[model samples]
Target chain A: MARAAVKAQAAEPLDGAERILQILSESARLFATTGYDGTSMRDIAEACGISKSLLYHHFKDKDEIYARITLGSTRELYQFVFDRLPEGARPIERIRGFMVATGEYFQRYRWAWVASTTAFWNDPEQRRQKERMMWRDRYENLLRGLIQAAIEAGELRPLDVPLAGRLILSSLNWMHRWYKPEKGMSAPQIADAYFDMILNGLKVEG
Target chain B: MARAAVKAQAAEPLDGAERILQILSESARLFATTGYDGTSMRDIAEACGISKSLLYHHFKDKDEIYARITLGSTRELYQFVFDRLPEGARPIERIRGFMVATGEYFQRYRWAWVASTTAFWNDPEQRRQKERMMWRDRYENLLRGLIQAAIEAGELRPLDVPLAGRLILSSLNWMHRWYKPEKGMSAPQIADAYFDMILNGLKVEG
Candidate 1:
């Protein structure tokens, strides 16, 4: 209790944006570990080293915080990948760009990325739900568009565009299930490996 | 309440094995939709149309039900895939066999598959956890071993075996996120499409 009080005192002086970021980071870590239903506002407050009132002042409830973290982080992901792909670049390069950027972002915000996947979006928060789906759709469509372009450019063979998009997304999105930052291969290396396999069939060239 | 009683009356007439299967099916669906924490034993009982006492008679608690659902279903999956794969099958055929069997099992037991992925294994149920992890490892090793054999047979180029295994799993496992039975493509069709992409590069061959 004393330690929590000390921590709360220390947190009180941070600027609003930094405090919010800290709250989000800590809450995401908690949510990723304990799950959405298992986590409560009190838990987030304690985890953030802030008092309940202070936590509530920034966000009304757990759902709002979850929505913020999921939607905000997703928007950042879309922008990060979008900005990395250069104009007039080949479709294949854009695909590469998307994979690399996603790996970097995922590694940097591993907690939030994991939490975003697990977040329960079932409530009647229609506005946030619609916005969240928009971001998700945008992120997915970006890859699908790149695949479509690649097919048209004769870089990729004509295929089912949606399934191809799903294949790429699956390889990247499922990383949260097993990819650990401190363990085996780093995210970019794995992404590169996947890119290699996707670009070149596993079969011998002969 | 009358409907629930009538449902319970109907459930009572089943044999022990059939009653257990009904309990597992209802529990898996509830656990899939509402999540583990969000679901209660009472909810399971109501969903199964069984009395709380009767539900407790079969499974001690929610954890046991979850363990039974995840581990038992996984065991069945391993056996199903193993049975489909012949002993002297070539490495590529084993890979195809694994993928197709997985799609079929996933379609047949979609709720259990989804529940297994989301089931929290954090508690100190060490024995069940160990058994669960063992089944999971066995399942993953089967795929990895197939990839190793493919490389050895000169059927495929040498690559990171574990990453290759994960690529196949990622594509198939992520289906639970979006693929719907009532929707666009069947699971086997999607698996076949993924197989084609993995076997042949997305690029237009020169």
Candidate 2:
């Protein structure tokens, strides 16, 4: 009995992690549909074909699962942006690449991207603060580098890099809220529109 | 007893609407911080110094309240956008005025704007579809007019009016997700940046 109990205990965590992933995936779908406060652990568990106890065995609580989902998204976003920075590329080319990469990332992980940015506004205490800091540092660093490069290359007009960064990031980040995959406008199409708008001013040139 | 009961019942709805508004305001604050699914009607009632029964007397349910909040926002937005169409103004002046008005609306109703847009993505079956239809109609009409006027007046290049409208609206609509009043960037300032980028194109003329 003791040996069987030890083996069972060891197997539980592995089972728990798998269950947790299932719960989170279902929860994300529900949360995306119902809003976060509208969903519950029971809902997640029911969707996963498991009990609440099994759900808790893996996640500890709702916020943990939420954090995991967002962290996974952020990790993937960071990798997508950082991994594709070509060595010694021109500033304009680099910005274009970043825009394309951003569009592609959202195409694949659109729901995750939506939840992290919008849902972060709803988190509390330490989790909210930590997530905000992480996002700020990550985005600010990437933007600052691009802006500095653009200015040095005389590709961009003189502007406060951080402020310009925030403006550009805010405009891009807002895409997930309104972009629909079925809306005839593909990810690349939307990115191209944005690129043209940003690169060329709206007024007709003589 | 019957007369007193009738009086009480009639008065109840008036009281209920007021109470519901209070509950919604508190719920918005909480939901804006903790997320919609993360909050409960019990939590909202508790925060409002009311009982669950009293809360229920005001709202049929949480979804009812959510729907009301979004509808209210939509009504306000529609009024803001359409109430000031200047038939005699220059195209540039009209566009600039619209941008300014939009920026001010965002600054004043930031929470409601965020909540409603967030709900658009998170609640598709019940609320989002209707909201999207409303949004698309409003946007298409407004942009179609603006683009037509600009083209006739020899201002803007001949572009797909609906597409131009979506592009412009997308930039403005995305502002609520990241525009913090405390961030030293006023709504007008951000609007100016966006307006400049859109109106002037980013390329340096020889």
Candidate 3:
């Protein structure tokens, strides 16, 4: 079998990480479509076109699947935003780049966003909820720190640091509700418009 | 037993609309605590300390109860914001008043805010979903019109009108996720800070 695998790489279409991501991505859609309680491991197994045993091998239970989705999505999202911004970019530019990458990813991973919106704070499994919130706080604090640096450097105006962080992120996060790729406002355009509001302030430059 | 024939004045505690509101508000909390799918009419009945028949008598089903919660909450929220503002107030004052009212209500009715965050777009009951979105659009348009008026009157900078509206409301709506009454920041204080950022511009006088 090892020799045959080496001879025909296409036989195992997806590598291990890719296979796991595919399972997670597919399960996220299901969890989004049906409430978390409404989705079962058998459902995920069927959706992934794998046997139930294989599904368990990948995920011990739905709670683990959900925890992975939440953590994975959060980590990937933070990495995508930070990595996409070129090092040494101005703080304001860094913000715009982060928003653009985030908007693009939100558009692409609509299901994951929806899945995260589910109420995990009150989850019966306390560990999963705590794990999710830990990552969330990390994301919030890092973003808030970037904004604070801009304020300190005089690149941005001083305001309530925590509120500013929430404001910027809320605007971007709400995109999943209304953004339509077919509607023709590209993600980059949205990033520009949002930055316009955030950096320029809504009151016409006095 | 049909009201005890004009018995004690305090015998029947709540009036018709008030009674319904009480039920909806309680159910909203349960829905927030437990996923919508996890909630049952029997559970709502139990939560309200009423018989299942009485609960059904008021709401034909959970869909009806949910629809009422969404619509009632939206209508009350809109009225709260608009009614709180005095006629002919300056755009800045009007905006601040509106924010304060909204923030107060979001904190007060935390459960309804959580309920609205749930993914109703793909709800199995399409009618309930559409009914909710219609009110949502009405709220959005009303808010957008107020912002446009501000821009036209030179109170606000000319930015993307719709985007500005979304940004402001999104920031307010997200309060449920993070705001806690015991967090030392009052709802009105949060509102003032938000209005400060939105109206005064975040950038130091450029």
Top TM-score hit: 1
Residue A110 in model 2: lDDT: 61
TM-scores, in order shown? 0.77, 0.65, 0.74
Best by DockQ: 1
Residue-pair clashes per prediction, in order, are 0, 16, 2
Alpha-carbon runs more than 4 Å astray in model 2: A1-67, A120-132, B1-68, B120-136
Q: Write the per-residue lDDT of candidate 1 for residues B139-194, one digit (tens) a residue.
A: 99999999899999998898888899999999999998898687677787788789
Q: Report lDDT (Cα) of residue B156, candidate 3.
A: 89
Q: Once superposed on the true structure, which residue ranges of model 1 sit more than 4 Å away at CA?
A: A1-27, A30-66, A120-124, B1-23, B30-66, B120-124
Question: Whole-model Cα lDDT per candidate?
Answer: 0.79, 0.65, 0.71
lDDT of 1 at A76: 65
Per-candidate alpha-carbon RMSD to the true structure: 7.3, 11.8, 8.1
Calculate the i-RMS of every candidate, to one decimal place.
Answer: 1.5, 2.7, 2.1
Higher-scoring candidate on DockQ, 2 or 3: 3
